[model samples]
Target: PFTLRDKGMKHMVGKNWRDLFDLVIVQAGKPNFFTDRRKPFRKLDEKGSLQWDKINQLEKGKIYKEGNLFDFLRLTGWRGSKVLYFGDHLYSDLADLMLRHGWRTGAIVPELETEIRIINTEQYMHSLTWQQALTGLLERMQMYQDAESKQVLLEWMKERQEIRSLTKNLFNPQFGSIFRTFHNPTYFSRRLVRFSDIYMASISCLLNYDVNFTFYPRRTPLQHEAPLWMDQLCTGCMKTPFLEEMVHIR
Candidate 1:
């Protein structure tokens, strides 16, 4: 899947951006993709074919590593913090980009829904357990009416109150609010569009603050306000196969 995606992306850009842009960096292999200076980027043909011979002789402006981000910024003459780096991973993309370069950073979590759903499921499980325990105790109290049993029931009631308190604590409003942000179909759909716009603008500003880059915004027109089946499946599939199969069989 990654190979196909990369191929599509490489095909789209081809050698065009190379000529149009002031500088073009290829095979970035980001987030430790370029950590080792020994690893060289093999120049690619227009069709994304590798030219290894040219790779070895590649020079500083052409291509080289031990190439720090600061050096790249200075060389590019990027004068301001207007440069924004967009990456999907929080730690690798935003964390490293912001920490190392202080560049404007936009982090994309493609599996936003799945991450939220996983959190919601965990909360639901806790809620279910507490409800079950409380109901069971209530049933037991009604079934037995002896003096000793009634005293036991009173203690159980106190325990039930504590359990309810614990449950409330377990399902905190702040945490629930975050989870609910994703679950609310209306809210997420609106936010997703806004997020894409914000990301693109941020990236554009970083590349060149005064210059305008082509902006192509498409919603892909979801059939329903909620995420479609494929989006959910694609996002959910990011989990380990064992975890996916566990849900699949049930």
Candidate 2:
């Protein structure tokens, strides 16, 4: 039930604009849309009747003509260094704007390929290293346990403690630098585990700030959870004699 007229007309008029600009173009032949086919430009009247026949030739001040954006800019006498061209397709609009016309182009990829690759690569390397180290450590612990070797166990524990201390020392400065560079405490805290050991203290010490004071005690593994309704309860009930005694005992 569909025809070329229906599909073609819908494609041409589907774009919604805020307001009419200096020129309104329709049925613009975008070459990238087709790989091998070359469709010629057609100028049509209000009734969609062919008014002019220029095929691939460009005409000034006319609609649906085969023309480059550079030619249009030249004709309009727009001279400025602040021109910015934005496009979703990098190879088509952005490439032509930047390489051929020397215009500043911003390419927007819905999912940035470079960023994805970087993140994936980092994760892959880190995971492989961590998994190998953990597996080796587990194997050594099992060997010591089966052999009933207390000296071996003690030596292993000492080595682990030394490694942990060295890791903490190295990572703390890098963690602080990450926080300082990003300037966002919450984001740093959330992604802290992914960073190297040197950055661990930056995440741990983030709660030192007044805004983050409440989160510090919560991070402690031994900290107990307060009752759900503790805040909503009366202050007198919160500070009851039995509660004060229990707190003092602890």
Best by lDDT: 1
TM of each candidate vs. truth: 0.35, 0.31
lDDT tens digits by residue: candidate 2, 99-177: 5456654444433343334335644335333333433454444455545566665664565455444433332434422
Best by TM-score: 1
Candidate 2 weakest lDDT stretch, 10 residues: 193-202
Tens-place lDDT digits, model 1, residues 1-250: 2244346655987734345444445646566652434454454444545566634333432433233354454346553357755665555555555555556556454445444454377555564344444445456446788899788778757865665554444435344332243224445445434333334322334555545654444445343444445523322223223223334322
Window of ten residues with lowest summed lDDT in model 1: 234-243
Q: Distance from true position, residue 100, model 1, in Å?
A: 1.7
lDDT of 2 at 35: 28
Model 2 accuracy (lDDT, Cα): 0.41
